[model samples]
Structure formats: structure tokens, C-alpha cells
Target: MEILFYIVPALMIALASCAVAAVIRRSLRISRAWNSGLTAEARCLRTYTTTSGGGDSSVRTTVHHVYAFTTRDGRGVRFEEQGGPGTTLEGDIVTVHYPADRPEHATARPPARGKLVAGTGCLLAFLGTFILFAVGFMVVTYAMFSAVGDFSQP
Candidate 1:
């Protein structure tokens, strides 16, 4: 039971670290693609919305768009990704950045630094809250056991 006190906080920290690393890695990849001139004018082929969750209050919505383009070497590529709904429409042209070798792993644009910072800050805050709760629980449990003294039979 006491092991849980250590495990919860460690798990939260690990999750936060992984999330931050993913964000940085993605940012670097996007930067490299743009700087290397691996870009193409992709056309929006179709747009769709997906919904998930069971309860009324827990419903979630995501807008996904499918795009197709031709690379400089004359390779046709098609991919789907989540994006703003109204910002793009069927037949709208958008610039896509991707690696020369893997056109499937592409992004519509570079990530916004401001949004990244805000997201990281939020993640850290969430981790901090869980750590505090775990520590508080451990302290309270220890205090209760100490006050009750040892239970032994003679």
C-alpha cells in the first residue's frame, strides 16, 4: 500500500517528460522539413468530423482533412490529419512540409511556439497537483498510523 505513494508521482513525472520530448522532437522535424525545401502544394480532397465519448458532457469532436499532392520527383502522396474545420474547405490549396523520403509523415505548418509553451505549462501544473496529492496522502496515512500506536497481542 505504501508503494503506491511513490509510484503515482513517478508515473506522472514520466508521462509529462514523454509529452514534452514528443513536442520538441516534432518541432525539430517540422523545422528541418521546411529548411530543407521539402514542400508541396497539397489540395484538400475531403473533410470530415469524428465524434467520440458516451456521455453528453464527455462528448469530443475532432476535424480531420484529407489532402493529396505530388512531390518534386513526381510521386503522388495522400494523407489525412486533424486541422481547423472552417479554415480549410474541400478543394482549398495548402502548403505541406514533409521529408523527401517519407511524405506520409507531414505537417501543414510549423507548430506555434506560444501554444506549445501554454500546453507545457498546463502539463506541468497538472503533474504538480498530482504530486502534492500523493505527498499529502502519505503524510496523512503516516500520521494516522503513528497516532494509533502499534497493535500487538501478548
Candidate 2:
């Protein structure tokens, strides 16, 4: 029981550190990919619905899309990604960034909505970590003080 006082805070700190690193890594990846090329219009070739996580745990529907685009040098390229509702649809024209030297590598050009969502998630994780650690520290400190008792009176 008392051991939990130390263990829980350690776990909370570790979780926060790992989540922060992950968010940073993801941001770097997107930034590098976008800077790799110029924007090009891509047409969604096909879309399909996929179910993820079910059975009273977690469940959500995601749209899988395949897009085709022609590069500046007249090379046809295809890219696929999964997105939420209405994010991807058949025949929908979307702007994507791709390396001129490598049409095979392409990504949606800085989707504002996705960035907002990711930022919000990272913020929440950090906030939760702080709250958890503060509460745990208070509980442990209170327990230790109470155990020591008032020594001023001798």
C-alpha cells in the first residue's frame, strides 16, 4: 500500500515523458515529409470503411483511401491513408505534398484539423501527468507528516 506512493508517481512521470517524445517525433516526421516537396492535387481513387477496436472496449469507423496523382515530370503516383468520417471519399480532389524526385512518397499537405487534434491530445496528456503527480505527492507528504506527529511539545 505505502509502496504505491512511490510507484504511482514514477509511472506517471514515465508515461508523460514517453508521450511527449512520441508527439515530438510525430511532428518532426510530418514536418520533414511536407518540406520534402511541393503541393499537388490528388484524386481519391477508391475508399473503403474499416472497423477498429470493438466488443465493449473501443470502436470506431475509419475510411481507407487510395489516391493517385501525376507529378511535374508526368509520373503517376499512388498513396493510401486512413481517416475519420468524411475525411476521405471517392473522387474527392485533395491537395498533397510530394517530392518531385520521388513521386512515390506523398502525404496530405498540412491538414489543419489533424494538427489541431494532435496538439490537443498532447496537451491533455501533459496536463493529466501534472495533476497525477501533484496529487500523489500531496498524499505521500501528508502520510509522512501524520506518521511523524507533533514534536514541538516534547
RMSD of every prediction: 4.1, 6.2
Best by lDDT: 1
Model 1 lDDT tens row, 1-154 = 5556557766775676676677667656655666566888999999999888966678888899998999999999998888555579899999988888778777776546577557656766775676677567767867875797545533
lDDT of 2 by residue, 31-78 (tens): 555777577899988999888788877997877778898887778899
Clashing pairs in 1: none
User: Scored by CA lDDT, what does every candidate get?
Assistant: 0.75, 0.72
Deviating ranges (above 4 Å) for candidate 1: 52-58, 110-154
The number of clashing residue pairs in model 2 is 0
Best by TM-score: 1
